[model samples]
Target: MQNPSPTGISKTVIWLMSIISGLVVANNYYNQPLLGLISKDLNVTESAAGKISVLTQLGYAFGLLMIVPLGDKFLRKKLILIDLILVTLSLLWMTFATELWMLYATSLLIGATSVIPQLFVPITAELSSETQKSANIGLVVSGLLMGILLSRFVGGIVGEMWGWRSMYGIAAALMLLIWFIVYKMLPEIQPNFKGTYFELMNSVIKLAKTQPVLQLSSFRGAMGFGSLCALFTTLVFHIERPPFEAGASVAGSFGLAGAVGALAAAKVGGLQKKMSINRIILYSILILISSWGFSYFAGDTYWGLIVGVILIDLGVQSNHIMNQTNYFLLKTNAVNRLNTVYMVSYFIGGSLGTYLASVAWKYAEWKGVCVVGLSMGLAALLAHILFADKIYKKQLNQ
Candidate 1:
C-alpha cells in the first residue's frame, strides 16, 4: 500500500466517523441493562449473567492487545471492514443464543470485533492537524461515549418491548448498515510500519517501556474506567430491588444523565489549550471521587444515581481524552500501537471492575460496589500524583 499524505479531515467525515464509532461500540454495553432479563430468560443466576459483561470486556481487552496494533501494519479501512463483518455475524449468533454458554460465546466475539472504534480514533488523530487533533479526538470520543450510554437506554426499551434477542437482531442489522457505509465513505490509509506482524506487536512493549507518559496515562485511564465500570455493571441489581423495583428501562434511562458528560467531552478536549494534562487528570479524579460519594448515598433513588452518573462520566471522559492527547504527542509513527497498549489496559481495568462489582454484589451488594469504585478512583489519584513529576523529568531528559 502507498503511503498517503496527511489530508485535512472535514467536519462531515468527523461526524461520520463518530456515528460509526458510536454504533460499533454500542454492542459491548447492550447486555448491561438487560442483565436481569437475560438472567431470567436463560434460567441463570444474576452472578452468572454478570459474566456476560465481564467476558465481553475481557475479550475486548484481548482484542485491543492482539488486533488493534495491526492498523499500523495494514490498511485500516480493510481491517475495519473485516472486523465489522465479524461483529455483525457475532450479533446474529447472539440473536439465536438459547443457552447461557451460547450467549457468553457470542458476547466474547462481539466484544473482540467491536474494537473498530479504537482503530478509528487513531485514524482521526492522524488526519487532523496538531491544532485540531485534540478537538477531533474529543468529538469522536463523545460519540463513542454517547453510544455507551444510549445503548443501555435503547437496549432497555427494546428489550422491554420485544425481547433481549430482538435487540441483538437490531444491532446486527445496524452493524451491517454501518459496514456498508464505512466501506463506501472511508478512504484507505497506508500502513506506517513495514515490520512483520510479530515485530509490530513487539513494538508495543518497547513503546511502553520507553514512554513513561504512555504508562502513566494508561494506568490512570484504566483505574478511572474500572471505577466507572463497577457502578454500571451492578446497577441493575440495585434498581430492581425493594424501593425502586424498577424494570430494565428505568435502570437504562440513567444513561440519559451520563449523556450530559458525553456532551461535555468536546469542551473538555478544548481545555487542552488552557490546562496541563496533569491538572486535568487531577480534576477528573476528584470528580470521580465525588460521584462515588453520590452513588453510595443514592441507594435506590434516581436523583442521586443521576447526579453520580453525570460526574463519573464527565470525569472519565475528560481524563481519557487528555490521556490520549498526551499519547498521540509521543510518536507520529506509532499511534496505533500506542492505542493498543492504552486500550488493552483500559478494557482490562473495565473487566476487573465488572468482576469486582459482581463479587461485591454477591457478598455485600450496593455498598460494596461503591467502596470498590471509590477505592479505584483513589488509586488512580494516588498513581497520578506519585508518577507525574517522575514522568515529567523523564520526558525533559529525553
Candidate 2:
C-alpha cells in the first residue's frame, strides 16, 4: 500500500476539490435570499423565517465540533462521501417541506452535512509542497469563500423565476453528480489517532483550552464572520422594501458586488508574506468597521450598500484567511482538531450574528443591522489590540 504523502497529488485533483468545496459550502447560504419566499409559501412570519438561518448555523457549528475531529481518527475520503449523500437528502427535504418545523429540520440537516468542505481543506494542506502550500490552501479556501459570496445571488435569481423550492430541487440533483466525482477523484488518508474515540474527543477539548494562538485566532475570526453574517442575513429584507421595492434577484446582486472584493482578497497569501499577520488582522477589523460608516452615510442610496458590500467582503475574507492559516500551521499532527476549534467558534459567531441581525431587522430596520455589524467590528478590533500580539509572541517563544 502506498503511504499518504504530497507526491502524486495532481493539479487536477486540487481543482476538483476546490470546485467541490465551493459548491458544497453554498448549502448554508442558499436560504438567505429565499427567506421571503419561504415565509409566504409556508405561512410563517419574517421572524420565523429568520430562525431557519439561525438553526442552520447552529447545526453547522455542532457538526464541526462533533464530526471534524473524526477526520483525524478515520478516513477523510470516506467522511466526505458520506456527508455528500446526507446533504442531498436534506436538500430534497427542504424542497418538499410543508410545515415550518419540517423546514427547520431540513435546515439543520443541510447545515450539518454541508461540512463536507471543511474536510477537504485539510487534505489540500497535506497534499501541497512546502513552498506552494499557502497558495494551494488559498485556492481551495477562496473557492469555498466564493461559494459563500455567490450563493445568495444564485438563490435570489432562481427563487425569483422558478420559486424558492426549485432552487433546493436543483441543488439536490447537482449533489448526486458531486457524489460520483468525489468517489472517483478523492484520495485516502491513513488514520493517525492512536486512542479510543472518547480519548480523541478529550484531546480536542484539551487543545482548545491549551492553544493560545488558536484562542486568539478563533475569537477574531468569529467577530469578523459575525459581522458578515449580519449584513447578508438582513440584506434581502432591507433591499426588498422601502424606495427600492425590488425583488429577490436585486437583493442578491450584492453577492456579486461582494465577490469582486473576495476575488481580490483571493491573493491573500501574498499579503501575509509582506505584512505582519497581526497588522493585517488589525487593518481588516478597521476595514469592516469603516465599511459600516458608508452604510451609515449613504442612507437610502444603493451606492452605499454596494461600497459596503465590497469592503465587508474584503475585510472579512482577509481576516478569515489570516486566522485559519494562523492556527492551521500550528500543529501538523492535529490539523483536524485545530480546525474543529477554530471553525466552531467561527460558526457560533455566525449564528449569533444571524439571530441578532434578524432581531435588528425586525425591530429597527436597516439602522439596527448597521449597529450590530459595527459593534462586532469594534469588538474584533479590541480583541486584536488586547491579546493578538502578546499571545502570538508567547506561542513563538515556546
Candidate 3:
C-alpha cells in the first residue's frame, strides 16, 4: 500500500514564520491610528493627511501586482530580504520628511515593500500538509492580523511618548531585526516557474478570466475587506471627538482590545477543521454587521466603540482566514498570482472605504460611517451566499 502523505512542517518553523511574517505585516497598519498625530506633526489638514492612506494602499496594490509575482519566478527568501531592506530605507526616509509630499512618497515605498507578509503567508500554505493547511494558514495569518490590530496601538503609544517621527525610526529598527531573523531561520525555497517574467505576469492576469473560483473569492474578499475598512476608517475620528474626546494615545489603546480577536483566531485554529468554510464566512459576516449596528451607539460611550471594534476585528480576521485558506488550496503554482488578484481588489475596496468614511464624516458623522459599513457588510454576505456552495465543493475536492 502507498504511505500517507506528510505535512512537512516543524512547530518551530511554523512559529518562526508566523512571528516574522506578523511583524512584517504590521508595516501595513503602522499609519492607521497615528494618522492624526502624523498630520499634526507635518502640518497637514485631516483630508490632506488622508491622502497618505490612499497612496500607501495604492503602492501596496502595485507591489502585490508587480512584485509579488516574483515569488513564483524567484527565490522567496531572497525576495523577502530585499523587500525588507527597501522597507527599512523607506521608514528611515519617513523620519526626515520635511513636507507632506515627502511623507507621502515614503509611505508609498513602505507600503510597496510591506508585501513581505504577503509572500510569507502563501509560502506557508504551499509548504503545509493538506490536512493541516487551514490551521497552518490560520497560524500564519494570525500573525498578520495581530500586526494589523496591534500596530495602531504601538504607533499611537510610540508617537505619544517619543514623537510621530520616532515611531518610524522604531519601525525601521524592527524591520532590520525582522530581516536578520528571516535570513537566519527561513529555509531557502526556489521558484518552480522558469518561464519569462512576462509569461508569469500574463498567466496571473489570465487567472481573473479563466478561474471562476478566483473571481468569486477575490470579489467576496474585496467586499468584506472594503466594508471592514469603511468602519475602521472612521473609528479614529469617532474617538477623537465629542462624547469620547479621547487623545491619540487613548485611541491607540483601543487597538490593544482588537488584538484579542486576532489572537482568538489563532487560538481557535482547530475550528477550521470542524466548521465548513461557508459557515465560517456566513457567521463572520453576520458578526461584522452586528458590530457595525452596535457602533451606531458608540456615541453614547467609549465602551460602545471598544466593544464594536472587538467584534469587527474578530469577524474580519475570521472570515479573511477562511477566504484565504480556500484560495491557497486552489493551485500551488498559482498562489502568488491568485494572491495578487485578490489583494488588488481588496486594496481597491479598502481605498473606497476610506474615501467613503471621510465623506461620511462630513455628512452623518459616525452614523453615516456605520450605515456605509452595514450596507457593505450585507452586500458581502450576499456575494458569499451566491458562491459559497461552489467554493466549498472546489475546496473539498482539492
Candidate 4:
C-alpha cells in the first residue's frame, strides 16, 4: 500500500534516510583502506589490490544502469529493503572469503546491492518541492558524501583492531541495523513510470545519447571522480611506505579531512540560489587546481596532506552537487535517466582512476599519482572554461 504523505517530511524520516544512505553507500568503499591489509593477508600485490576498487566501481556502474532505473518503475521502499537484505548477505560473504577471486566476487555483489542509496536520493528529490529541492538534496548528499569519506576511516580502524575480515562483519551487522530502521520508518513510494524494465532501460540508453547536460555532467563528474580516486588510491600506498610510515589507521584519518571538504558544500544550497552553476563549476575548478598544487609540496607532512585533501574534496563535492542540481533541473521527468547517465560516467572514471593509480604507483610512485590527479584537474578546468558559455545556455533553455 502507498503510505500517506506526512504533514511534512518528518525528522524521523530525514534522520533515517541519512543513516541508511550513508551506510549503504559505504559498501563501495570498504575495500579501499583495507587494500593494503588484504594484499598482504591474501599474498597479493598492489596491482591485484586495484581490482577491489575497479570491480566495485564497475559493479556500481552496472547497478546504476540495471538497478537504479527500477526506482522509476517499482515501489522504492520494497526495492530498498530487498537490496539492503542482499547487501547484508554480500557483506557477510565478504567476511568469509579466503581467496582473491572470492573477495572480488563478493565486492561486486556488495556494489550491486549498494544502489539503494541512489534510489533513496532520487525519491527524496521527487518528494520535495522545488523550493526545498536544493536543501533536501544537500541533506541526502551529506549522507552519501559521509559514507564515501567515512568508510575508509571506519574500515581502517576495524581492520587494525579485529583484522580485515572483521571489517566486513561490522558492515554486515550495520546493514542489518539499517534494515530494521528503514523497515520501521520509510514510506512506500510508487514508481513514477509503469513501463516494462526493457522499455525503461531503452529510455536510459536514449537519454545518454540525446541529453547534452547528462553527457556533459557525466563526463565532467567522471573526470573529477577519477582524479579524486587516483589521489585516494595512491594515498593508501604512500602512507604505508617511506618517511611517514603510517598504519591503516593513519591512512584512514585522512578521510576525516576529506569529510571537512564535503561539509563546506553545505553552503552550496545557498550558493546555487545566487550564482549560475557554470560559475560554480568554474570556481570549483580553480579550487581543484590549487588543491592539487598543494599536494605537490604536501607530501612530507600529515597536516599538509590534510589541507590538500580538504581543498580537493571541497572542489569535487561542490562541483558534483552543482552538476547534479543542474542536471535534475533539465526535465524534472527525466531525473532518473539523467542520473543514470551522470553516475555511470562517474563510476567509469572512478574505475579508471583506480587502475591508473596502481599502474602509476608501479612506475613513478606517489609523484606519478599526483601528476595524474593534477593533469585531470587541469584538463577538466580547461574543457569547462572552453565550453562554459554553451553549456550554461543549454541548461537555461532546458
Candidate 5:
C-alpha cells in the first residue's frame, strides 16, 4: 500500500535529519585536509595523493547513479540504515589501510555509501509543506554544508594529534553511534515506485530529458561545484608552500571561514518566497566569479585566502540550494530519482574539477588552480545568462 502523506515533521526530526546529513556527507570530505598528511605517511607524492580526492568524488558520482535510485524502489529508512553500515565498514577499512591502493579502494567505498545525505534531501522535501519546503531543505543542507566544512576542521585537528589513521577510527565509531540513533528514531518511508531496479534507473534518464529546468540547474550547479572543488583540492598545496608553510591543521582551519558562508547560504532557501530562482542563480554565479578573483589576488596573504574561501562557499552553496529547490518542486513522486540525476552530475563535475586542479597545481601551482576555477565560474555564468531567462519564463507559465 502507498504510505499516507507525512502530516507534519517535528523540529526533532528535522534536527536529526540535519545531523545525519552532516555526518554522512562528511565521509566524502574528511580526506581533503588530511591529503598532505596521508601523502607523507604513505610515502606518496602530494600530486599522487590528490587522486584520492578525485577517486572518492568519482565513487560518490557512481553511487548516486547506482544506489540512490534504489531509494525510490525500496523502503527509504531501511535503505539508509544499510548504507550507513557500509559507510561504517568503509571507515573501518580506511583505519587499517597500510598501502596506497588499500586507502584508494576504501575511499571509493566511503564515497559510495556516504550517499545517505542524497537520500535525506528528497525525504526532507517530501515531508514538508510547500511553504516550508525550501526552509526545511535549507536546514538539512545547512547541516550538509556544515559537515563538509567541519569535516576538514575536525579531520585536520584529529589527524594532527593522533595521526590520519586514528582519525578514520574515530569516524567509524561516530558512524556506529549515528547508525543506532537512525535505526531507533527514523520513521519508515514507504517506497513510491513499484518498478524493477532496471526500470527505476531508466526513469532517471527519461526525467532528465523531459525536464529542461533540471538540465540547466544541473549544469549550473555542476560548474559552481567544479569551481569550488578546484579551489579546495589544491588549497593545501598552496598553503604548505612559501610564506605560509602551514600544517594540515592550518589548511583545515580554512573551513571555519567556509562554515560561515554555509550558514548564510542556508537562508537562501527561505528567500525563494521573495526572489526568483533565476535571480539567485545569477547572483550566485557573480559571487563565484568574484570569489576566484579574490583568491587570484590574495596570493600568500592569510586574509585574502580566508575571505575568498567564505565567498566561494557562499556562492556555491546558495546556487546548490536554489537548484535543488527547483528540481524538488518539479515532481513530488520522483524526487529521489530527480536527485539521482542532478547529484550524479554534480559530483562528476566535482571529480573533474579536483583532477584538473591537481594537474594545474603540478604546472602553475596556485596560479594554475585559480585560473581553472575562474574559467569554470565564467562558463557557468555565460550559460545562465543565455538560457535562464527563457527557462524561467516557461517555468512561470507552467
Candidate 6:
C-alpha cells in the first residue's frame, strides 16, 4: 500500500526527492549568511542588502500561490522538470550579476522557481505507505530543514574563501546536476484536479476560506516561521557587532544549532503514531515562545544564541510537521492546493519577519530584534490558545 501510486517509486527515489528538495530551497537562504558581505561588496547599507532576503521569501510566497497549485492540474514530473530548468537559469543570472538590481531580479526568479521542493512534498503522502506517511514526510522535511541550515554554513565559508558570486556559481552547478538526474529518474504521477486552471485556483481560495483547520494551521505557521526568519536574517548583523565581533562564517555556524533542532523535529514527527497532535501543537508553540527568552541574552554570550536556535527550529518545524500532516488529511485529492494555501501564508510571515527584523536591527540592535521576535511568538501562542480546542474539535467532526 505504501508504494503503489504509479507502482515504480522506491525508497531510493524518495531519498533523491528529499535531496533535490533541499538543494532547490537552498538558493533562498544562501543570502542570509552573506548579507554583510553583500552590503560591503555592493556598496549598500546592511538594511539594503537585507532586502534580498525579504524579496527572496516574497518571491517564494508568490510562487507558492501561483505555481505550486499547478501540480494538481499537470503531470508533476513535467512541472517539476520545467521548474528546475528555470531554477538553473535564475541561479546563473545570480552568478553573473554585477549590478544590485540584477541581484534583486535574479533573487526573485530564483525564489519563484524553487517551488520544486513543494511539489515533491505532496507526492510523498500519496507515494508512501499509510504506516510510513508521517515518517516519510519527516524525512523529506528534514532534508529541507538541513538545506536551510547548511546553505548558511556553506554560503558563509564559500563567500568568505572565494566570493559570494562563487557560492551562487556552485549552487547553479548543483541544480544543473539535479535537473539531469530528475529527468532520468522521476516517474510521472497524474494530477487530481480536472477543472480549468482558473477554477482550480478558485477552489483553492474556497478551501482557504472554508477549512478552519487549515486556517488555524496557516496562521500560527506564519507567526512561527516569521520569528525564525527574523532571527536568521538579523543574526549575521547581531554577531558581527559587540563583544563577539565575529565574521559571517561564525554566524553561519549557528546553523549547527538549527541542525540539532532539525533532528529533534524529525524525532517529534515520529510521535504522530504515539501522541495526540494537539499536544504536539501546543507544546511546540510554547517551545517557540521560550526560545525568544534565550535569544534575549545572546548579546552577552554565544551559548544563548545556540540554545535559542535549537529551540526555535524545534518549535517551528514540529508545528509545521503537525500542520502539514493535518493538511493532507483534509482532502487527498487536493493536497497540493491545500499546501499552496498553507505555505503562501507561511512564507508571507517570513517576509514580514525579515523586513521587520531589519528595521529593528537599525534602531534597537539585538535587543529590539528580541522584542520583535517575542511579539511574533506571543501572537502564535495567543492564536493557538484562543482557538485550538473549538477549531480542532470542529475539524475532527468534519
lDDT (CA) per prediction: 0.90, 0.86, 0.79, 0.82, 0.89, 0.88
- Which stretches in model 2 have alpha-carbon errors above 4 Å? 1-9
Model 6 / residue 203 / CA error / Å: 1.1
What is residue 157's positional error in candidate 5, in angstroms? Answer: 0.8
Ten residues in sequence with the least summed lDDT for candidate 4: 1-10
RMSD to the native, candidate 2?
Answer: 1.8
For model 5, the superposed segments whose C-alpha errors exceed 4 Å read 1-7
Better of 2 and 4 by lDDT: 2
lDDT of model 1 at residue 132?
86
The per-prediction tally of clashing pairs is: 0, 0, 0, 0, 0, 1
Q: Candidates ranked by lDDT, best first?
A: 1, 5, 6, 2, 4, 3
| Candidate 1 lDDT by residue in tens digits, 1-398 | 22224556777778888888888899999999999999999889999999999999998998898899999999989999999999999999999989988988999999999999999899888888888888889989888999999999998999999999999999999998998788888878899999898898889999888788899999999999999999999988899998899999988998888999878865887666787878888998899899998998876678889999999999998889889988898765899999999999999999999999899999999999999999999999999989997887878887
Clashing pairs in 2: none
1-398 per-residue lDDT for model 2 (tens digits):
22335453567777787788889988899999989888888888989998999999999998898888899999988888888889999999999988899989999999988888788777767666766667777778888988997889999999999999999998999899999988877778887898988999999999989988898888888989999999999888888788788888988878999998788777877877788878888887888898999887784789999999999999998888878777777756888888889899999999999988999988898899999999999988998899987987787788
TM-score of each: 0.97, 0.97, 0.94, 0.96, 0.97, 0.97
Model 5 lDDT tens row, 1-398: 22324565666788898988998898899899999999999899998899999989999999999999998899988898898888999999999999999988998999988999899888888888888888989999999999999999998899999998888898899899998888888877889899888899889999889898899889988889999999988888888898999988999999999999999999997676677888987898899999987899986799999999999999999999999998888855998999999999899889988989999999999989999999889988998999889887887798
Looking at model 5, residue 168 earns an lDDT score of 87
Error of 6 at 62 (Å): 0.9
Off by over 4 Å in 4: 1-8, 395-398
Q: In candidate 3, residue 167 scores what lDDT?
A: 83
RMSD of 3: 3.3
Candidate 3, residues 1-398, lDDT tens digits: the string is: 11122556666777787787778767767677778887788777777777777778788888888899899899988998998899999989988888888988987888888888788777777777887777877888887777777888887788888888898888899999988888887877779889999999999889878777677777767776777777665677777887777767787777788888777766555776677667877888888778886788754587787788888888877777877876776765778888888888878877777778778877888888888888878888888888778766775686
Deviation (Å) of 142 in candidate 5: 0.5
